[model samples]
Target: MGIAVNNINKKFGQFTALNNVSLDFPTGELTALLGPSGCGKTTLLRIIAGLEGQDSGQVLLDGEDASSRHVRERQVGFVFQHYALFKHMTVFENIAFGLRVKPRASRPSESVIREKVTELLELVQLDWLADRFPPQLSGGQRQRIALARALAVEPRVLLLDEPFGALDAKVRKELRRWLRRLHDELHVTSIFVTHDQEEALEVADQIVLMNKGNVEQTGSPQEVYEHPTSPFVYGFLGNVNLFHGRVHQGVLDTGGMRLDVPGHAEAEDVAGIGYVRPHDLDIERYAKGAEGIVVQLIRAHAIGPLAQLELARDDNAELIEAVISAERFKQLDLKEGETLVVRPRRLHVFVDQPSHHNQDAR
Candidate 1:
């Protein structure tokens, strides 16, 4: 079912947790409410699930107001970060809890509940562990059981809040794909909340980025990642080298380090800030008289696929990070406090003076 939240505002006394926010999620698609902690993603999700009421707005399910509905009546299956499985219940019992909780008139027969629980267990690839309790299961397995429990109700909408955040890095990555596949199989409209930018980009069909209780951008993952609508969105979504300067002849003079930015004619002589992605940065051999100096190497980590370098950029004394293959890092022989030439071909500039319309345009 599609969900439409109109001008939802929530507050806890003087703390306005959610401002005048409005969003519409279409049916059967994975929508992500993405933001850092305290950005109100969880509050919004709870409001949609009827766990908490909005001060001023309507929660509409398929164009019908559902604000007055209770959490149990909303038919929203919630998968929390902690899994939240009952320790004493076996996987089967946990998955069957919801069905058994309903009144006699609404509860299914014993055979029906068993069949449904078994089917869901198979769907989550956990039928083999059906007899095990939550403590006997691994973290990932427990989460799978929690998911199976949520699906037992066959909820119209699934709301997942950091469903895999508590797992190990490798397992979390695997479960992200698994969750996407499950979403495809179920075709249930799901809204997932996450603070991890890569997770949101990899999993969700559409993304809504919020900041300070306001909707900053809503688009496809690539659209929002590639073309961030504001400085906050650009900085928050990924590592970016930000330098405040002015544009001259369509090229930004970043404190004498020149960057060619096309289609920014009006920014000449106007103060602006430039952002360049870490992957877009090029290492200049020390002798080429490169634009940037490695003022500080904060840390270098071997994160499987790439060796990430955290360094201080000379221009504006801002910290910058770069990710390169092991082979590349070895060829460069980069060490702590070694000056390297870093150049960027593309540019993302923001007009500083304007309150709005600060975007990352190529």
Candidate 2:
């Protein structure tokens, strides 16, 4: 089922949690609500699930007004970060809870419930642990059980709030990949809230990036990462080097280097910032009259196929980071204290504005 919120607004005492937020979550696709804490991602998700009411605006499910519906009425499955499984019940009972709680006329028979629970356990690949209590299961196993429980009633929409946040790095990685595969099989309209950029990038079909209670950008992972609409989006989505400079006649000149940015080609001079991802920087051994900024290699780390370098610009003593293939690093035979010339192969320039100004009033 497709979900949408229109002109949504919410407040908490003196602070506004959401400001005119609107978004469309296409049917049968996994969409991620991504942002740092206090960005209202969870609040927005809650409102959509009918757990919290919006101060104004509407929540629509399948093009029908669901803003006034109760949580039960919405028939949405929700999974929390910490597994909220019943401590006293066996995993089997927990998975069967939702089905068993339906009104008598609608509830499935005991035999049917048993078959459904068993099928769900196998779907999550945890049928072997059906008799174990929540405490007896590992964190990852418990989370999978929580998911099975949520799916018991066959909800039209599934909402997960940082479902893998509590797991170890390796477990989180495993679970996210599993979640993606499960979504493909079920084809349910799903929305998950996460602060981890990597998680959203790897799992979701589309990403809705939020900040300071407002949606900043919404697009496929590649689109948002490669074509950010704002400085915040560019910086938030990944590691980037920012060069503070002044733009004059389409050229942005920092103290160390300059780049042609025709997009901001106004004749008038203005403060701007040039953004360059570390991987986009081309590094070379410095020559006496070489083009690009000259920097001294301060640190180098090679792990697997990638090399991460830290350099200090000679002119301003500002730090710069670059990433290159491990093979290239070996070819250079780089050592600390050696000077190198670095130039950005691509640049994105945006007018400088105070970040605090984008935030809503407290």
Candidate 3:
């Protein structure tokens, strides 16, 4: 089911939770509502599920008005951060509860329900544990069962609110890939709310970034990551080194290093605050690049094939970071406080506005 939200706004007492947010969640696409705490991602998801009413605007499902629909009428499968399965109920019973208790108009026959429940159990790979209670299962197993329960009802849309927030790092990583495959197989229109930037980038087909109860920017993960529409988007999307500089002689210069940004792109646009990600930075001791004094060297971390170097730039500048291979670092004989050339082919320049100004705001 394709969902089209137009002019949607929400308010809580004196605070505005959402301000004229408009978005299109195309059918079969997994859209992520990503932002910091109190950003209203949960509020938006509630509005879609009919749990919270919007102050104004419309929610159109496949071109039909659904704003006035009841919560049960929306038929959205919701998964919460904490698994809400009944402890005494077995996996089969928990997944079967939704269908068994649904209204007569929506409920299927006993045989049909049995078939559907069995199918969902298999889909989530918990069929053998049908008789097992919630406490008998691992966190990942419980999550899978929760997903199975939600899917058994065959919802028109799927909504997840930090579904993996309670799991450990390894389980969360594994579940993300599993969810992507499940979405592909089911093709249910879905929206996921997350505060983790990496989760948003890895899981969503489109990302909606929000701040202060308002939408900041909405785009594909790559589009938002590579060419952020606002400074907040740049900072919130990934770990980036920010520089304070300006355009001199039609050239963009940051910390005395000239960038190759074209004149048409507005050198001063990001002049006051230029940005570069860890992957974009290069490290070498004074090899004709962005020169800076290393005031501090952060603890090195071994992240698979790459090594991360976090450096405190001189003069209280934002932390400069670079990701390099351990082998390359050994060859260069890297050390603490050593000067390095940090040159990147691409940099993002936000217009010289107050740091508070963002990409999309009411």
In terms of lDDT, the best-performing candidate is: 2
Best by TM-score: 2
For model 1, how does the per-residue alpha-carbon lDDT over 195-270 read when each residue is reduced to its tens digit? 9998999999999999888999999999999888788888888888776778755667767476666656556477
Off by over 4 Å in 3: 263-271, 287-299, 353-362
lDDT of 1: 0.85
What is the lDDT of every predicted structure here? 0.85, 0.91, 0.81
- What digit string (tens of lDDT, one per residue) describes model 3 on residues 91-183? 999999999998899789999988888899899877999999999999999999999998888899999999999999999999999999999
lDDT of 1 at 117: 94
Q: Tell me the spans in candidate 1 whose CA falls farther than 4 Å from its real position.
A: 287-307, 310-316, 330-338, 355-362
TM-score of 2: 0.96
Q: Worst lDDT window (10 residues) for model 1?
A: 353-362
Q: Which candidate, 1 or 3, has the higher lDDT? A: 1
